[model samples]
Each structure stands twice: as C-alpha cells, then as structure tokens.
Target: GDSVTQTEGLVTVTEGLPVKLNCTYQTTYLTIAFFWYVQYLNEAPQVLLKSSTDNKRTEHQGFHATLHKSSSSFHLQKSSAQLSDSALYYCALSASNVGDNSKLIWGLGTSLVVNP
Candidate 1:
C-alpha cells in the first residue's frame, strides 16, 4: 500500500525565521508523484508544490520541497517564515500513469503557526 507520513503535528516559528516540515512516503507501485498541499483557515486546500522527479525542487507560494526517491522523503522548507504562511500542510502521494484511481494518499497534516 502507498502511504504518506508527516512527522510534525504542529509547528510554530517566529516571523523571519526559517522552517522545515518533514514528509516521508512509501509506495509499492512505480511512477508515483508527490504533492504538498496547503489550506488556510476557512479556505480550501490548494497545491503548494509537486514533484515526480527525484531530487528536483518544487515550489509555490514561498514554500518548497524536494522529492528524494532514494530516501523516500519530500520535506518542505521555507527560507523565511511569515505570519501569513501559517496554515495546514499535507504531504500526499499519487499514482501516475498507471492507475485509474485519482485519489491521493495523504499524511495526517501539519499545522503551522507563524508568530510576530
């Protein structure tokens, strides 16, 4: 079975500091893609980054993550934390080019809080 894991249940940072959110995944199938999704309070979840290619960085909205197949990790990072960046983050896995199933295998999600 394919699965995603996010070790942090909650994270807090001062604005202007850096932050990292750990994500790891396991999959039995080949050709899988990974995604990072962000959802602010009362807002729908939206994709922040995605990568199918190992070791390549994917970034959006000031957040970035790199998928490393060798390590089965896709940890998210930001150079600087902003108060507006506080949100819920999820790491997810999707089967690519080999399945009719469109649903993503998602982690429990990390709640990020940035303070002034």
Candidate 2:
C-alpha cells in the first residue's frame, strides 16, 4: 500500500514571500507519480502540479515541484506568495501500473493562507 503525508497542517505567508508545502510518500514501486491538488474555497479540487519523470521539475500555474525518488518526496513550492493563492492543498500518490487497486492515496490537506 502507498501513502502520502504532509507534515504541516497550516501554512501562512505574506504576499510576495516564498512558500513551500512539504509532501512525502511511501510506495513499494520504484517508479510512481505524485500529484499536488489545490482546492479553493467553494471550488472543486484541481491538480496544480504532477510529476511525469523522476527527479524532473513539474510546474503549473505559479507552483512547481520536483519528485525525488531517492527521498520519496515531492514538495510543492512557489517563488512568491499571493493573496489569491489561499487554498487547501493535498498531496496524493498513485501508480501508473495496471492494477485494480490503483486508487490515489491522499494526505491530510494543508491549508495555505496568504495574507496581504
């Protein structure tokens, strides 16, 4: 079984400051994909970033993440925080393998609050 974890329950950052959402995962497979999903207030959850290749940086919108297989980490980062960046962020794990149990394992979401 695979699992995703985000150590921080809440993260607060002022506008223009850098922000990072920590994410770690555990999986038996050597190759897998990691995803960062963001849900704004009253909005449905949507993928903000996803890893397509090992150790390669994947980015979307203003966020980016580099999946590190060696450390089993795929932390999402933003160069500068914005007021509109406030959302609930989820770290999830899923494999590209052909299995009936290929469901995504989601972590307890992290609340990102950007202050003006």
Candidate 3:
C-alpha cells in the first residue's frame, strides 16, 4: 500500500527562525499526487501544497517544497519561520483521479511549536 511519513515528534524553535519538515513516501503506483496539509489548532487541515508532476516544486501560504520521485521525498521548508507557522503538518498522497478510488494517505503528523 502507498503511504507517507513525516518527521516525527515536535519541532520547537524561536519566533524568528528557519524550519524544515521532512517528508518521505512510498507508492506502488507510478502516477500519484503528493500533498502537504496544515492544521491550525482547532481548524481543519488545509492544503498547503500539491504535486503530481515529477520534480516540480509546489508551494502555498508561506511554505515551499518540491517533490522528488527519484528520492521518494517531498520536504517542506520555510525561510525566517514565524510563530504563526506553528501547526500540525501532514504529508499525504492520492492517486491521480478521485474517481480512481484513490483515497488520500496521510502521515502521522508533525507539530511545529514556536516560542517568542
């Protein structure tokens, strides 16, 4: 089965700092979409990024990341990270089409905590 995995445990840092959330995956299907979702405290998870094209970088909000099929990874990175960046991040994957019965597979979740 296809699956995604994110950096485990909480990442704690200062208000103004750089942050990177590691994400890796494995899939038996050749064509699949990778996604990054962010869940703020009580809010529902929102799509932060999505990629179906191989080797192309995708970004959303204040984060940027690229999908590397050869490496089987899609790492999220941000410059001068902020306190607002604190949230639960999840790496996910879905098959090309929704009609294809491609349910989204999610990571275990990574918590980003920022301090002043």
Candidate 4:
C-alpha cells in the first residue's frame, strides 16, 4: 500500500518568519510523482508544486518543495510567511504512468496560519 503523511496538523508563524510543512511517504509503487496543493478558505485546492524528478526542488508562489526519492520525502518550505499564505496544504502522490490502476495517495493535510 502507498500513503502520504503530513506530521503537522496545524502550524502558526509570524509574518516574516520561515515555515516548513513536513511531508513524507511510504509507497510500493514506482513511477510516482508528488504534488503539493493549497486551498484557501472557501476555495478549491490548486496545485502549488509538483515533481517527479528525484532530488530536485520545485517552487511556486514563494513556496518550495524538494522531492527526495531516496528518502521518500517531499517537504514544503517558505522563506517568509505571509498573511495571505494561510491555507490548508496537502501532499499527494500519483502514479500517472501506472496504467488505469494508478491512484493518488493523499495526506491528511496541514493548516497554516500566518500572523501579523
């Protein structure tokens, strides 16, 4: 079985501080890609970053994530937290190339709250 794990259920940070949301996974499936999604209140989730390449960092909208296949991890980080960055963040795994049986494994998600 394949699954994603997000250790933090809630995170709060000052407006100018750095924030990290940990995401790790265990999967038996190969040919997998990882994705980070963000959803604001009353909004649909959108892809913030995604990567299939191992050991490379992917970034979007001031946020960054590195996919380390060797470690089975894709941790999200932001150098500076902003008030607008508050949202629910999810880490998901997809095996797009694994035929029709390919499925997505999703984390429970982390809630981020940036304070003034």
lDDT winner: 4
Clashing residue pairs in candidate 1 (N, C-alpha, C atoms within 3 angstroms):
none
Q: What's the ranking of the predictions by TM-score, best on top?
A: 4, 1, 2, 3
- Candidate 4 lDDT score at position 28: 78
- How high is the lDDT of residue 107 in model 2? 93
How much does candidate 3 score in TM-score? 0.90
Query: Where is model 1 poorest over a 10-residue stretch in terms of lDDT?
Result: 95-104
TM for candidate 4 is 0.95
lDDT of 3 at 18: 81
Model-by-model lDDT, in order? 0.89, 0.88, 0.86, 0.92
Per-residue lDDT over 1-116 for candidate 3, one digit per residue giving the tens place of the 0 to 100 score: 67788999899878778889999998876568888999999999998898888788777777889988889999998877888899999999886553566677889999999888
User: Worst 10-residue stretch by lDDT in candidate 2?
Assistant: 95-104
After superposition, candidate 3 runs with Cα above 4 Å error: 96-100
Q: In model 2, what is the error at residue 111, expressed in angstroms?
A: 0.2
> What lDDT tens digits, residue by residue, belong to model 1 across residues 1-116?
67888966899999999999999988777778888989999999998898899888888888888998899999999999999999999988986546555557999999999999
lDDT of 4: 0.92
Q: How many backbone clashes does candidate 1 have?
A: 0
What CA RMSD would you report for each candidate? 1.5, 1.5, 2.0, 1.3
TM-scores vs. true structure, each candidate: 0.92, 0.92, 0.90, 0.95
Candidate 2: regions farther than 4 A off: 96-100
Residue 19 lDDT, candidate 4, scale 0-100: 97
